[model samples]
Target: MRGSTNRNTRRVRGVLGAAIVVCAVTTALPGAASADPAGVARTAGAEVGTGVGVERVSVAPDGTQSDGGSTGGAITTDGRRIVFSSSATNIAPGNAAGSERVYLRDEPSGQLKSVGSYPIASPVISGDGEYAAYWVLLFRDTKVKLAQWTAGSSIGLNCDALNCSQPSLSGDGRYVANVATIGRPSTSQRIDVWDWHANTKQELAWFDHTAPSRPSISGDGRFVAYQNGRTKDVFLWDRDHGSTSGPIEGAAKEATLVQISEDGSKLVYLSGTDTYVHDVSTGTAHLVPNVKGLAIDPTGNHLLYAPNDTAGPSLKLRDLTAGTDEIVSNQPASAGVDAVSAGGRDVVFQSTADDIVPGDTNGKSDVFVRRFS
Candidate 1:
């Protein structure tokens, strides 16, 4: 349980006040889509190198935080902004009641701003750079609510009484997907996808006993991938056809974790102790030989994973298409890999290096960005 933290069941109710405050304020300028026609090309070009450059953006005890004792953050397409949660302030130690709020820092401007005062979790930015989404817990009734903000406005996406978690926005910022549990542990849980433009809601699927976590939408909004069951199996729900595929044929029953490609054509999941990639288009599964921690690049052609050695995990990048792989970074023997963000020409990950504060051996992780060469 060293790196694991239980999900927050205790809900907080400061969202309504936060919403009112956000609404009363004047809207900021709309975020313009990248004017560069070659934005995608620029990102793609970076992946071909050894590994993207790594930069330490946040460190524990340094004002870094996450929701409910857990880690969560966002990395925009352009890598200019990184929004993350930290418990460095406000909350009392060992008590989850202090509330985890969302905060954003612009890398270029060095301006860190709080996105209102609500207890927000799992912040995700839209593909178009125009919107952000997260879950806010209102303490009054312990109810979890879905909330969103565009450049010009903020609104709640409706959760009358049900508890909702894991909000994912589509590339175009038109849809948000999340899991809504009606009865908690005793009752079944259902995954729902909401169409923002249409202002409608529809159930995506139902689970008998297991609740889905970490629901991810593809860049094009064609597929959603989530972890399912005690088996730790990963499943994909196709959006266009309204069908489910995999527990991917050969994926290990109890040790799998899935992440879809940005294009939604491939599914990457951990199978047993090894990681495997499945072609959603062809249903073929291939072992990403010798790679662990398996984080797929945005293009789906490359994968980033930790190696088998415990001498602190190094970031390994593999070109799935060409069947080649390489270690992008070899940190000191004391560092361990945490998470990664693979954009166009850059890849970033969290690692525990030796210089971390002593006695803070909670395995606190720090962010590192690499230029992939």
Candidate 2:
């Protein structure tokens, strides 16, 4: 079901020019191999999802989906371990104690597991598939949790006395950044970073206004980027320097931050439906122009954007480093992209297009993944 090709070697190099392999350190696969000008290996890559490097992911291994729909796909860099939110009661057996909220799939083994038995959202997984983070609305307040993807044991980083939401994780799952709402007469939002290793939590900053924006933490937990509730602006907090540089967004008209790179060097945000990118090191930001894409590679050097400028109806990987774009998917994704694998090689997204894959006659929103090399 999977195959590889050396098509577009130059464009592929542009996408993988960086030093971040992101996908489980480039495990073995069948295909010819070579080196880029930078000397990075260009292997024809092996089977993913199915044998084709692209396949429907929101279903049973046998492609059963009469149960329910799935959304919010979060993944490890290799696309081997994908965790997502779903309402399907039958994606896997028993659903990890009857949980229809979140599920994890081991693509190589064709195994799946449900997260819990309650309502869950915004599921996120570590780059190495070591942990997963998410929020649950058990009652009036939403609680944030970090769970070991293997053991399923978790610790609640719910801020103790406040309602927390929008949980984001560092690639290693050692750091979790979430928004907590507290205060009396008027509620204010504070972004908190939790260190799973040290078992300590620190408040990055607070806003006078309350909002729904999530905070993104870097892979090492050294940096965090968020949207200020009061001014509709963006801010970056450096834990190493204990400094906060804010309002980094230029002319932001209610800009909302979407994701930050694993290194905190790049950030993606939406300003009234238009996608924008901010280079953290240079303190500069710009609208992507013509298309909207939210997923960023680990190095913050690439993005999975939709409505390819030349391809017409497709998703493209925009190389921030080379200032070029490569259409990754021949079919358009209905809900844009969910995440990009390391080096921007694998792309998973939500699509209602039946033609995206053969036998996708479900005609409903389903998750699909495609690999580009």
lDDT of 2 by residue, 117-202 (tens): 35456578887777777777756677776666566556666475447788888877887888878854337776777765665677
Give the C-alpha miss distance for residue 149 in model 2, angstroms: 1.9
- Which digits, one per residue and each the tens of the lDDT, describe model 1 over residues 163-251? 77777767666767677676644375656666656666656556655445667778777787776655466667776776766566434
Clashes of each: 27, 5
Worst 10 residues of 1 by lDDT: 29-38
The residue ranges of model 1 lying beyond 4 angstroms of the native Cα positions read 1-53, 59-71, 89-99, 116-122, 140-154, 184-186, 231-233, 250-255, 323-344, 351-365
Candidate 2 at residue 307, lDDT? 56
How much is 291 displaced in model 2, in angstroms?
2.4
Report the Cα RMSD per candidate.
9.9, 12.4
lDDT of each: 0.51, 0.64
Error of 1 at 255 (Å): 5.2
Q: Which candidate is the best by TM-score?
A: 2
